[model samples]
Target: MRRYPSLVMLMLACSVAVTACKPAPQAMPVDPEPAAPATTAAAATPAPVPARNECPYPKFDAFLKHFGNEITLQEKATADPLLDSHIDAEAEPEPRKVESRLALADVEWPVMPDPAALAGQGRELQVNTLADGQRQVQIRTPDSSDQQTYTFAQAPCWTLVKREDESI
Candidate 1:
């Protein structure tokens, strides 16, 4: 009877030990379904480009109006007969209206005059662009001579070349 009880206890302990030593079963792997393909068109559409406004040359009327009164006063004092004769001899026969139009085309604002010319004339020219897109040109002639300044409104981004010596 005593041997039977010990044998039963040993069997129960062996069964518990075996169950404790067993490894757990691994879980099965599950894969997700494949994603659908992206749709395609026959051709790729391009975005439209915005149109730019045509930039006109600077308004010469504004320039003339700004400096004309002052220039007229100076011209009376410094009128040179010989230089005037030479200028007239070389001048074109265009009417004042045509000349004004040509001058408009020649005076593209924001352009610096020839540095060499200014140096030769012993003068200094300074240009400044205003916040409102106008350009102000200040010219100081030789020996700090009477300063002449002009403001050209509605100017364009281009280089300007004087057509004649008188144009300067």
Candidate 2:
């Protein structure tokens, strides 16, 4: 997907103006590659999206018991076949397909942080329940230099959920 230079400039400017504390996520340049023939029935329809928009992770004491905040996400990035990058001339000039799949069994879950471990520490955690039922957690550790905030949601982009403004 080719982005317009002017539009990209505008977005960059807007992001710079809006976020001064944290780095804004920049859009990755999309390079469309050729697609291969689909032989399976699963390839006929598009991949299904999550049914709900709520946080998929457990929260509060339950979170501490099971998975304590530490999480990792794995994704498969793909684009249309509009470039020659996916083509192989020496081996089968005819493109069969270009795809990568991640098996559920292949995913390795990280060790979750124990809430009890942070009990005696001066770190303070503030969990806010939003109107949309998602939770945003703000962590202000003993070191006043840096603070971190994260949101949890059912969508793949759980961290980008809106939060209550604390500008006042």
Candidate 3:
């Protein structure tokens, strides 16, 4: 075996030099996660309930009175996709009832007449409760052929679901 003292010393010197020139080890940077939005009293509040589920009036009569006058209340009291029926006098066969579903946007407002004001306007208004607890309101002119019937059902509160216009 041959001993290379100079070679060993040279290798040791090179290793020391390399170690001295090398940069110190550093910890990797970490990014923090975003925080959630704060929940205040207003933010934590529940969504508004539908008008059909709320009954501010004790009787149907009072509800109808307010429903006809207030446009906002009337819109809320009316059902979406309302069932609209009218006589189709121009049908191929004899005149027949044409039924169509009308969306909230398509529905004409103020279709209902206030019972209290009907008599004053020289129009007769009759409200009858059906066997199924639905209110049928019939509005008619004294001698004119104009007439309209509105049907309201109470699921949790009175809501106008259907309208039949027999007026020519």
Candidate 4:
């Protein structure tokens, strides 16, 4: 897929924003009073370590940069048997809601739109971090109902799990 100038600018801006918003590492405050020594019994029993999500690249912005630009990375990051939901345009009298799974082998490459291309075509792109912690990337034509939303979840690392096509 060709890279558009607008898309490059968008990604660059996102990168800068993410970098700018990161909090600087601060030095741990020094305690005037020393912490109490643990008892021998307490030392014998090791404190339980909290489990953590170990995804190397946990930031959605970074993941999205690759997702839009690289097909192989997108395929690898997407969930297998992806949940695809949309209106079935083939219905006899009227379109009907349909839900299906697209196995990794069956998925058409580059399902995601290039934001630059969309902008060039006079479509608008909106990205939101939903209340439920999922990220939604939506593209639509202004003043029109033509829209699609791609929902992603951080299953350890970001993964494209659902797509909702609302376009007519």
- Give the winner by lDDT: 3
Residue lDDT tens for model 2, 100-146: 33243443333223345555666666778779766666655554533
Per-residue lDDT over 1-168 for candidate 1, one digit per residue giving the tens place of the 0 to 100 score: 575998899899999999778765554334323222222222344555533223222344333333333433223222122111013333356422112223332333322343336657777766677796655566667554345454444423222222223222
- Arrange candidates, best TM-score first: 3, 4, 2, 1
lDDT tens digits, residue span 105-140, model 4: 888889687665777799987889999899999989
Candidate 4: regions farther than 4 A off: 1-56
Structural similarity to truth (TM-score) of each candidate: 0.26, 0.31, 0.65, 0.62
Clashing pairs in 3: none
TM-score for candidate 3: 0.65
Instruction: Give the alpha carbon lDDT tens digit for every residue of 1-168 in model 3.
Output: 149988989999999999888866664334323223344544787888757535876489898888878878778888998999998878876878889998989887776866778878999988999999999999999788688899999978888999998875
> Clashes in model 1: which pairs?
none
Q: What is the lDDT of residue 2 in candidate 4?
A: 59
Of the candidates numbered 3 and 4, which has the greater TM-score value? 3
Among these predictions, the greatest TM-score belongs to 3
Candidate 2 runs further than 4 Å off: 1-61, 69-113, 155-168
In order, the Cα lDDT scores of the candidates are: 0.41, 0.43, 0.82, 0.80
The C-alpha local distance difference test score for the whole of candidate 4 amounts to: 0.80
Candidate 2: what lDDT? 0.43
Candidate 1 error regions (>4 Å)? 1-116, 155-168
